[model samples]
Target: MRRYETIFIASPTLTDEQAEELVKHFEGIIAEQNGELLKTEKWGRKKLAYEVQKFSEGYYTLFDMNAGPTLIAELERRFRNHDSVIKYMSVRMDEQTKAAERQKVRYEREGRRKAQAGIKERSLEEVMG
Candidate 1:
């Protein structure tokens, strides 16, 4: 399974419940297709760079998942068919991208560890002195 990131904008007129239902519907598709959903984020309504479907703002949602080609095709097909979806895009994360993400995470973890260690060392020195 390859990793993918998908973002879609839903019509701003949708009620909060309707928007939540839309997200759940897509999530069900991923699960039914044997895809692993890694993360989901709702960015809420935001201004677009330009008007889309004659609406200046839309509810933005993002999905990060691992799935095969067939699942991706099905997911995109659903997106295209859904009326509330104003704009959508999906990008496959290649080996290079995955490596970069892992490297970034490692750096963050190391930085945190070092900061904690430095704090502990300073406290010990002050006490001993």
Candidate 2:
């Protein structure tokens, strides 16, 4: 599995209940595909940089997940088929980026452990003493 980020814009005309249903629809897809959804952020109704589908604003939703390529393809296909979806994008995060994130967590964890253990780096004289 690889980490992926997807941001999609839905038609602003949708009612709150309709919008929630749309969000749940996609979330269900991820679950059905055996993918893990890391995060879902709804940035409701923002002005578009430019008009799309003759609409000046859209309801934005972002998804972060760990999934295989097939899930991404399926999600994109579904997005394209849905009339309410005005725009969508999916990007796969590189392993280097993932590794760096893990490395940062590992470093912080080690630092906390060292602090708890009362272990600190010392100069040669301090070590000898």
Instruction: Name the best candidate (by lDDT).
Output: 2
Q: Please estimate how well model 1 matches the true structure, expressed as its whole-model Cα lDDT.
A: 0.93
Q: Give a tens-digit lDDT track for model 2, residues 1-129.
A: 999999999999998788888999999999999999999999888999999999999999999999999999999999999999999999988676988999999999998999999999688999899
Q: Each model's C-alpha lDDT?
A: 0.93, 0.94
In candidate 1, list every pair of residues with a backbone clash. Answer: none
Model 1 lDDT per residue over 1-129, tens place: 999999999999999899999999999999999999999999988999999989999999999999999999999999999999999998898776988999999988887998988844357768899
Q: For each candidate, give its TM-score against the true structure.
A: 0.74, 0.74
RMSD of 1: 7.3
Give the local distance difference test score of model 2: 0.94
Error of 1 at 25 (Å): 0.5
